[model samples]
Target chain A: MLRTYVDMNLVSGKQPHAWDLGEFYLIDRIRALVPDIDLTDDCAQIELPYEGTLLFTTDAAIRGVHFPEDSKYIADGGFRALAGAVSDINASAGKPLAALLALVIPPELTLSEFDRFLSGLLEYSRHSEVPLVGGNISRGDRFGATISVIGSSNKVVTRSGARPDDLVVLSGSIGGSEIGRMIISGEASDADIKSLDSEIIGTLLYRHLRPLPPLGLGEKLAAIGATSMVDISDGLIADVEHIAEASGVNIHIELGKLPLYPGVTEIAQRHRIEPAILAAESGEEFELIATMSLKDAEELEKLQMPMTVIGRVRSGNGFVDVTLNGEPIPPGFSEGWKHF
Target chain B: MLRTYVDMNLVSGKQPHAWDLGEFYLIDRIRALVPDIDLTDDCAQIELPYEGTLLFTTDAAIRGVHFPEDSKYIADGGFRALAGAVSDINASAGKPLAALLALVIPPELTLSEFDRFLSGLLEYSRHSEVPLVGGNISRGDRFGATISVIGSSNKVVTRSGARPDDLVVLSGSIGGSEIGRMIISGEASDADIKSLDSEIIGTLLYRHLRPLPPLGLGEKLAAIGATSMVDISDGLIADVEHIAEASGVNIHIELGKLPLYPGVTEIAQRHRIEPAILAAESGEEFELIATMSLKDAEELEKLQMPMTVIGRVRSGNGFVDVTLNGEPIPPGFSEGWKHF
Candidate 1:
C-alpha cells in the first residue's frame, strides 16, 4: 500500500522514491507535523461565529528576510510567522478561531527540513488555539508561508478611537525579540546571553522563535474599553505614530517609563547602544500599545497583566513626541520595519 | 494636509517623498486601486455566514512560477493569480463571499508598475464577486501574492463522493489556458492565434488571463446532487485521478468526447502535438469536473450549462483509464503538471 511505501522514506529523511505532487501525497506530509488535523472537505469548514463578529488578518514570513534561514533554525521561521499573524487579532482584542496556511515549498529543501518547518508552524497553531484547518502547498524557488487567521470579538477596537488625554499603556517590555536574535546569530556577548544561565538563554531563544501573544488579555482590554490599540510589531516609536495619525491626536511617550525586557539592558550594554533607543526601535516584539481612561487602566493593572503606562495621548495634528523626563528626545525618530 | 502630501506622488509614478510604512500609508495605496474599501478596524470585519457552512481555501502565485513576470503583462499575473484562487470555491459547489490578499512587493518594481499590479488584482477580484476585504504587503526580492477565499454553500461536495457507475462531467473545454500562455510568451504560431479574428484572439487571451469559473453553476450542480466535484486546474487527466483516489474508485475517460476550446485544436496542431494529449495536459482551465448519478446528470444536461459527460466511474482502486473510441490510446499517458 502507499502508506507502507511513504512510511519507509519518512524516518531516514529521504523523499519517497518517485514522489509526486498530488493532493493525497500532501496529506501525509501535513499529518507528520500535525497528527490531529481534521481532514477538511476540499477546504476547511468552520461553523459561522454567532456570538460575535469576524476579525480576519494575514501575514507572511520569508526565508532570509523575516528570520534566519539557517538550516538549523528554519523551523523557527514557521513558528514566528504564525505567531506574528495571531498578534493582529489580539491587537484588536479578538480571539483567534482558525488559520489557513499557504506554503511555498522550495524543491531545494530536503523533505526533512520542510517537515521541521511544518512542526514549527504546528507548535504555535496548537498553543494559540488557532487550528490549521486547511492549507495549500506548492513548489517554489524559496520557502515561505502566508498565514491567514480568522477570529472574532464582540467589542471591536481600532487605531482610530484614541481620545486626547487617554493613558497610553504598554502591554509588556520590549527588545526581548531583538536580543534573542542577536544571541542566535552570534552577534553579541560581553554580558553574552549564551554565557548566562541555561534557563535564561532558553527563555530568550524561545521568545525569539515564538513570542507568545498575551492570550485572553484581549477580553480584559475590551471589557475595560480600550480607546485605541495597535500591536508592537512595527516598534514602539513607529506604532505610536500609527495611533496618533489614525486617531488625529498627538502621543508623547515618556522614554524613561518604557519598560525593557529582562535581558534587553544587558544585551544593550554588550551591543554598546542606548537601551531605551533599542527598546524604541525593536520590531516583532508582539506586545501592545493601548490608550484608555486612567480609571480603566487601574482596573486592568489589578488583573496582574504585564502592562505599564508609557505615554499619554494629547490633542494635536497626528504627531508622535517622545520625551525623557519631560524633555523632547531628539530630531529624527528611529527607523521601523519598512515593507516597501 | 496629510492627504495632499500622499496624493502628490500618485500619478507620476514616484514613491511618496519621505514615505514611511505605516498603517495610514498602506490605506492610501489600497484606496488607489479599490476606491471604496471601508477602512477596516484593525482588520476587515465581515458578517458571519448565516445561510451556509464556511469553505476556506488559500493559494500562492510566485514570481516567474505561476505566470510570466514580463513588465508589459505584469498586470495579467495579478488577474490570473486571483482567478486561480477562486477556482477552489467553485470546485466545492460553493459561493465565494470574500478574499484576503497578501502582496509581496519587490523594490525593483516601479511605482507605476505596482499600481498596475494592484489594478490587475482588483480587476479579477471584481469579476469573480470575491471582494478584497483585507490584505498585507511586504518587501521581497520578487513579486508574489497569496490569496485566501472564504466561501459558503448550503449543500457541500467533495472529491470523495464518487460512486461506481456515476457519470463524469466537465464544466467547460480545456487547453485554452495553455494556448494563451503560448501566445503571450510568443512561443508558437501557425493557423496561429494572431492570424485569427481579433475578437476571438482577445477572448482566448482573456480566458488565459482570467478563466471564469462556472459561477453559480455550482448551485445547479448541488441542486441536482452532484456526488463528486473538482476544478480542472491540474489538467483533466490528473484531476480525474484525484477523484478516483479520493473516492476509492476508478475513473475512465473517453478521450474522443473530451471537449476542446475554440483555438486549442489549432494551437495544438501548430505545436505538432496531438490535440487530445494537449487537452489532457493543460492546466489552469478553472473548469469543474463532477460525478453524479445517471438520472441527475440527465437533468443537469437540460439546464443549458456548458457541461458534457466525458467519462464515467467504475469499481476499482484508484486507477485512471483513458480510451480512444473504446480502444486503448498509447504507450504512455501524457504527463500532466508535476508541481515538484
Candidate 2:
C-alpha cells in the first residue's frame, strides 16, 4: 500500500527531492488526521476554537548542532528537542495549550524511522498533555526539528523582573546531562561510569536524555511575586547572563553556593576536570532560575522541590560574576552553548 | 568566528551530531532576532493579552505532489504555497494576523538558495500584511513546505449550513489551472498557445501559480442568508460532494453550466481531452463554492464578480450528480489530487 502511494515521479530515481520520502509520508498521514480546512472561503471551519492566553516560543534542533549523527534513538532526540522547546514556555509560568512542530527529516532516514519519530513525538505530546494543534512539516537538507509551543498563563513572570538585592534561586542540581552525554559518546569508560551508584547513574542518564522542565514552579513563583526568572538551558551562569543583559543588571554567583548532583563532583575529580565546567557550562538543565525577595525565597524553600540561593543581583552593567572565597572566578573560552 | 565556534563541540567529523554545532552560536543568533524573549523563565511572555477569536490552519506543498521539480522560480513556488495556505484562512472572511512557516530545506540546496527562499517567503509575507511570527527550520530528505497561519474572523460560515434547494455558486471560472499546468507540461503547441489571448493566459497561469482567493465572498454570501459553502480546492464536483457530505444532502451539478475561461475549450479540444477533466478534476481554484437562496443568487448575479447556479441540493444521502443535456453524468475515476 505504501509502495502504491509513493509517486512514480519520485521512485523512478531522478534523485527524489528532499521531501520525497520520510517527511512526505509523515505529512500525508498527519494531514489525514486533520479535518477539512478552507482558508480561502470565509465559510471554512475548524474542529475547535482557541481560548485563553497564548504563549508562543520557537526552538530549533539542527544536525551537527544539537545532536550527533550516530546518536542513539533519533526518535528520542526529536522528543527531547521538542520537550526542551516546550520547557521554555513552561518556565515562563504558562499552561501549555498546544504545540506546532516543524520537522526536517534527512534523506538518509527511512520511511519507517520517520514514522517512528512521529510516533515518539505523539508519545511525548500525550505525556505532556499538550495537544498537537497545527504545524507544518517540510523537507530540509539535514535532519532538523523546529518546535513552536504555545501556552497560557494568568500572570506572567519575566526575566527582567529581578531587582538589586533579590535572592537568586535554582530548582534542581546540574551536570548530569553533560556527564550522561559524555558516557553516550563512549569517551568515558564503563568502570568510570560504574564507579558511581547504578541508580544515580541511571537517573543522570535519564536526566541527560530528557530534562523535565519545572512546569508549575514558574507560575507558583509568579503568584508569590518572584521578581525575574529564566531557564538554565545554557548552564546556570550563562543563562543568568541572559537575564542580566536583558534586565540591564549584574548577577554575581558564589561558586561554593552552587548546587550539584550526587556524583557530579566525584566524576569531575576523577577526570581531573573542573567541577565548574560540569556545573556552569553544561547545557539542557531545563530548571528555572528566578530572583525573588529574600523573604519569598525563604517561603519557596518550604516547598518539596529543591531551591538554592546560588547568587544575587546588583545594580551594574550586564556582567556575570562567579566568585569563590570572595574572589572572581575566571570564565572559560566557551561560555556554554551559544548557537550564534 | 564560525569556525572557532564549530570547534567548541565534542562531536567532530562526519558523525558530529546537532550538539557539535555549538549550542551557544545558534542561541545567540536566534536570540538576536528575538531580543524581547524571556528565556530565563518557563513559558514565553505574550506581547498582548488574549482577546477576540483566534484562527488557525496548516498547509503542505510537496515537490511532486504540489509542484514540478524543473519549474522556473522555486522561490515563487514557496511563496505560492504560503499564499494558498493563507487564502484558506482568508476564506473565513478573516484578516490574516501572523504565520509560522516551518520550512524543510533539501540537503543539496546551497546556503545562497536558502537565503533566496527566505527572501521569497518574506516578500509574500510583507505583501500579505502578515508578519512571519515564528517557525521551525530543519533539513529534510526532499523539498516540502508546510505553513500554519493564524487569522481573525468576525463571522464564520461553516460547510454544514446548506439547506435543501439552495442554489450552488462559484466565485470564478473553473478549469483554468488545469490548462495552465498542461501548458507548462509541454502538451500545448506554440500556435495553440499563441492563438489564445495573452491576458487570459496570464490569468490562468497566475491562478495556477498564485490564486487570488475570494476572501470576502463567504461573509458577503453569509450576510445575505447564504447557506453552506466551501472553497474549491479539490475539483468542483468533488468539493461540492464534500459540502453535500458535510450538510447531509445530495447535490446535482449542471455540467453545461460551468463557467470557463476564454481559451480553455480550444486547448481542451486540441489536447483531445474532455473539458470535464479540466473543469471537474483540476484543483487549486481557490474560489468560493456556495449554496444560497434564489433571491440572494439573483442579487449576487447583478453585481460584479462571477456567480452561477451550477447546481442545487436535495434531501438525500451525501451523493453528488452531474447533468448534461438532462442526463446524469457519471463520476470520473480521478476525483481529485490525493496525497495517499
Candidate 3:
C-alpha cells in the first residue's frame, strides 16, 4: 500500500534533518497522512457561507527554477506546483476553493522524494476539487512550492475589464511549453520525439507534464461575458500585454489567427526557432486569454467554444499589435518568460 | 526619499539575474511600489461583502531557517514573516483580512536588502490592517517569506474547543524567545546584555525583534468565550500539548503559574538552565494559550486581562499534567522547541 508508505519513509543512508522530524512530529505526520485535512487549528476556517468574491492566488515553484532537478519528470514538479496555483484560480473566473502548500524542502530531499512530492500534490489536489487547506514547511537551499489558490466567485473575472471593441479569445494551443522545455532540457532528443508524430509526442508530453488549465474554459468565459482575463503564464505576446496593460487598451494580434501547437511547426523547425516565434514567445501557456463584447463574442460563437478569435480591443496607448496577412509583424524577434 | 529608492535599486557589482528584472518588470515594479496593492489581475478579488468564516493561514520564513542573515536585525525578517502569518490570524480569533507574500528572493539580495525586506513587510502590513492582497516573487537558494494570512470570523475559535474544567489562560510572558535566540546566536553576549536589567534588555529585545501578537487579546478571548486557543508557538509545554491534543483533554500545568519573560529567572540562571525549564520550554512565545469559562474567567478578571490562570482542563488520555506545589512534577525535563 503506497509502496509500504514509500518504504517506510525512506531517506536511508543517514539523512534525517527536517529538524529530525520534530515540527510536532511533522505535524503529526501531516495529521496521520491528510485525513481529510482539517489541519485541526492555527487557521483554515474557510466556510465562506455564501455571498461571493475571494479568488486569491500566489504561485512560486523554484527547484532549479521551476522544475527539472535531474528530470525523469520529477513528479512533474509536484504537478507544476498545483498546476501553477490552479492557473491563478483558472484565470480569475474562479471556482477551486482551497490550497496552501508553501513547502521549501531540500535537506537532501528523500522520504522517497518527499513521497513523490506528495503524490504530485495529492494529484493536483484531486484534480482541483481543491481542499488542502493550510501550509508552510521550510528547510531550504532549493526545492520550492508556494502555491496558495483559494477561489470563489459571483463574477470575479478581472485583468481590469477590457473595453474598446473587445474580442481577443484563445483558450488553447500555444508553443507546447517550449517543446516540453526542449524535452526536459536534454535539449530536445529522443530522436526529436522519435521524429515526431505520435500525436506530436502526446502533445509535447501533455503540454509539459500536465497543464490543461482552461478550467472549464474559464468558467465558460466567465459565463459568456468575460471582459478581460489572462493566464497564458507569460507568452502569447506576454499574455496579450496583460490584457493591454490591464485594459488601458490596444491589443490587435491576428497573426493568421494563431492557435499553433500542432507540433509547433515541427518543433520550431527542429529548434532553428520561428514558428511565428514559437507562436508568440513560448512560456508555460496555461492558455486562456479572453476579453469579450461583440455580444459576448456572438455568445461564444453560439457555444461551439473550443476558442480562438485571437485579437481585437482598441483605443490605443497600451500597445501590442502584430498582424501578418494584414502585414505589420515586426518586433525584433521572440521574448516572454522572464520571471524575475 | 526612501534613500533614493534604495540607491537606485542597488545590486551593484553587476548582480542582475532575477531573470534580468522581468516578471513584467517585476510586476511593473510591484505596481509602482505597492500603490495600495490591488495588483490588477490573476486572482486577488477579495470582496467578501459580509457573512463570515475565512481565516486561512500559512507562515514559512526560512533564510538560515527563520532569521539572522548577518542580522542587523535583518529587517526583523520582514517583521517575523508578517508576524508569523498574523499569529495564525490571532490564534483564530480572526479579523485581519488579507495578505499573501510567498517571496523567495536571493540573487545576491541587495536592492537595499530588498527595500529592507519591503520595509519589514510594509511594517507588518500597516500593523495588521492586513491588505497586501496577492504575492509570489520567486528565484531561490535562500531568502523566503510565504506569509498568507486572510482572516475573518463571527465566532471561530477551535483547537477543538476544550471542555472539562477549562481555565488554562496565559496571554503574556514565556521564555523571551530563548533569550532572543541566545542574543542572535552569538551565544549570548553583550556581556549577556550588560549583566541584564535594562528592563531585561527591553524584554529580550522585544521578545526577539518584535513579536507582539495577542491581537487584541485574541479578540478578547474570542469575545470572552474561548473554549480553546493556542499561539505560544512551540513552548509552554508545547502549546499546552496543542490544547490537550486538540481538546481530547488533560492539561493540568500549574507549576507556579508561569508568566516568565521579565529576565526569565535571570536568563535561566545565566544559562545554567532551569528557571522552571525556561518557563516550560522557550520557543517563540507569541503568547495566547486560552480555554476559558470560570464565568469567562471571572469576566476576564473584571476586564483587566493581561492574564495568567495557567491551568485546568481535565478528562484524560491526552496527557500534559506537571503540578509542583501539589507535587507530581516529574516529566523527564523540559524539552519543547526543537523545530529541526
By lDDT, who's the top model here? 1
Global CA lDDT computed for model 1: 0.79
What is the Cα-based lDDT of residue B174 in candidate 3?
A: 78
Residue range A1-340, candidate 1, lDDT tens digits: 6667567777666675322444456667686567655443456777776778788888889887787778788788888888898989998889988888887766566656777788888888878888888887766656788999888889888888999989999887888777777787777653576556777777777777778878777667878989888888878888888889889999989989988887778778777887888888878888888999887887886778888899899999799888877788884667885321
Q: Report the C-alpha lDDT of model 1 over B172-209, residue by residue, as the tens digit.
A: 78887777777876776644665566776777787777
All DockQ scores: 0.58, 0.27, 0.33
Cα lDDT tens digits, model 2, A37-144, are: 132233223332344445666666665556656534666666677788778776777777666665655556555456556666666777787666655554445666
Q: DockQ: which candidate is best?
A: 1
Q: Give the docking tier of candidate 3.
A: acceptable
Measured with C-alpha atoms, the lDDT of residue B21 in candidate 2 is 40
Error of 3 at B283 (Å): 16
- Cα lDDT for residue A33, candidate 1: 62
* Alpha carbon lDDT at A287, candidate 1: 88
- The candidate 1 chain B region of ten consecutive residues with least summed lDDT is B16-25
lDDT to native, each model: 0.79, 0.67, 0.75
* Model 3 TM-score on a 0 to 1 scale: 0.37
What lDDT does candidate 3 reach at residue B166? 80
State the lDDT of candidate 3 residue by residue for B1-340, as single tens digits.
4434334556344434442453445655666767777666777877774876887888787766777667366678888788877887788888787887878777666544666776777887788678787676867768777888787878878787888988888877778887777776767777756767687777687677678787767777888898889787767887788778878888888767787777767766876876766778877678888888788888787557578887888898578888765677777466776542
Candidate 3 C-alpha lDDT tens digits along A1-340 = 4434334556344534443454455555666666677666888877774867788888788767877776355677888888888888888888878887777777676554665776777787788678687676767777777878787877778887888898888866688877877776777787766767787777687687677686666777888899888888777887788778777888888767777887777767877876766777777778888888877787876667578787788987678888766888776454686432
